[model samples]
Target: MDSLSQPFTFSQRAQKLTGSAIREILKVTARPEIISFAGGLPTPAGFPVEEIHRAFDKVLSEQGRVALQYATTEGYLPLRQWLADQMTAEGDVVSPDEVLLVNGSQQALDMLGKLFIDEGSKVLVESPTYLGALQAFSLYEPSYTSIPTDEQGMLPEYVSSPEAAGARMLYALPNFQNPTGLRLALERRQELVERCAAARIPIIEDDPYGELRYAGERLPSLLSLGRKAGATVVRLGTFSKVLAPGLRLGYIVAPRAIIDKLVQVKQATDLHTSTLTQMAVYEVVRTGFLDKHLPTVRDLYQKQCGYMLDAMQQHFPASAKWTHPEGGMFIWVTLPEHIDATVLLQKAIDKLVAFVPGEPFYAGADVKRNTLRLSFATVPEEKIREGIAILGKLISEA
Candidate 1:
């Protein structure tokens, strides 16, 4: 009788999707007075502004109409070829046909979900995985199986066993993973690929931070290692961290057959990423500018990370623990067992300091309440020290 009062019903898939916790917190952290460590944002200082400006001008001067026109769903040909060449240089052999450019890596996660997930299908993730991955995959509503992880990343034994037999795919960020900021040790990487191969499980190797290493030896990507051993792997990469997020450009490297399917879905989604932007990006990166620019970025990030860690050591309670990341933008903090990170966040915000509570980063029931994630890359050393000081006192008082 009260149809007027009823709202439009949402699809079951849409109903399960929730907003990103970090995104929502960004609104509060936006206050200039607040010293925030909540976001995994890259240092904007590293963005080659003058170079990008020149590239855009050059693109317009050279390929104006073609750059502005609709591009192939598979992506800009030269950029795709450039990616293939770069991969080959990195020792991950692949052809340009194997790479499909997407709007960004975020879209790749959604597309992978479209390709692999079904209702009640089993999906494996690290105990604390990327919140964005959870948000993207949750729309498909898979039964999540959180694999146990250590400071070295996911444990291979649990994921390779018969108990994980029903899982459709394993999603992992083996290099400087979000939230955790921990890398999968080099020794464990090959074992993981071998085990997942034996388990007959396909892998989605999400690697947006592999190139941002500050210290330690560079490791081989799972896509390269897995392919060498004849395992199926879908690799996702993005220029957001290395280049600029505003460009919204990324690519997927997979088998030609799988890439063909993804191209169809991507066409239905956005037709293609901005043709002008793709051409402009190619102009900027074509001359190996990133190779020269990235070292400065690494040095800057290393200095900032050291500053943040030093602050944490000076101020946190004895029971509090945190990860020491060799690279990337985040540091995962674990407070005393009795301390709830969400509650701690409320107190810190009042003191004009903010951090993302780690509970939202988990997919299953055994969520950790005492943990949180901190990003040091975007914050200056002075603010990082000040913010950590305030957050430290708040936790101790609590």
Candidate 2:
């Protein structure tokens, strides 16, 4: 590689953009020997490989030419319709036209940033929200306002903070949010919808983990409530969590007007999501495969989570605390007030265990350095026990 002897003049945005801390760490943890809980990767055991293969074969045989043809920016008709049906079943009463398929929910987030954000625009998010979202939205350089969050999730009440008071929109994860597996209470959802509607602030509800619940009652999405409240809601949904991430399929449901604008932007972004993949995913999931497959996924994750939690209880020092997620890939672990998780990650890597420190999830310096996120979906129960035991011992010694 030729090094630039001259100073390269990168764009201001390009200059500021940095890689995800977790992704950078993944370079080292990619070693097969590492017991990593760093990435929010799904369990390989839960992938519907056989069903996907069958679906792909069928699509290639029956709809060969069309499957390979260029698709509209709005995505495949049947797939969008299926997603609408799924949302309707979940009580959103959506139209297929309102759903625009994307490469993945991550791309949808990028599209949203392009659609709604401007330089210095106020964007609100949960204090310790999904790091990917923060990294995506940062490209547009929106001024972020971190909402106060707790075990109950991001608070929906009035914001007195002068910096965050006039935020244009709130980016929330009401169902098993990443980093912190805290699901927002139904009461909080209702309050948030009503308040945001009254304030004329739109909401972007990112819900990739909505259906993977293993315990407690499944609450209505913020979009569902926002619709009933007559507020603007744009919700991103993905098959990445439930199916395979490699499929790279997801969609966004919003008002048709917003969908129209996004469609134009998307046409300029990428012509469309892979038509073949969308067709195959629809074929696999159309006749109730996820309905059957998800229960097993839920059970596996629940068992793994239980093992980690039990191990944490037995091995972690009393000063450490962790959130109990009902359903999702992560558990948020907060260590003693004095310990920083970023530093602890080095020690964990030395012990052959890895996790994502929570600091990068925050937009700015108002971060909890003592917190970290652990993933249980991919690791086996025995590995979960061993890894958490090692992490707990380290925390105890720290």
TM-scores of all candidate predictions against the true structure: 0.97, 0.97
Residue pairs clashing, model 1: none
Candidate 2 residue-wise lDDT, 1-398, digit = tens = 34366466678898799998988988989988899999899888989999999999999999999999997999999999999998899899999999999999999999999998999999989898899999899999999888888889988874435666677788999999998999999898998988888777889999999888999998988889999998899999999889999999989999999999999999999888899999999999899899889999999889988988898899999999899999998999888889989899999999999999989989866898999999988887888888888988889888
Error of 2 at 143 (Å): 0.8
> Which runs of model 2 end up more than 4 angstroms from their true locations?
1-8, 159-162
Question: Model 1: runs farther than 4 Å from truth?
Answer: 1-7
Q: Give the per-residue lDDT digits (tens) of candidate 1, residues 86-199.
A: 998998999999999998999999999998899899999998999999988888889999998999999988886666887899999998999899999977889888988888
Candidate with best lDDT: 1
- Candidate 2 has its poorest 10 consecutive residues by lDDT at 1-10
CA RMSD for every model? 1.5, 1.5
Candidate 1, residue 335: the lDDT equals 86
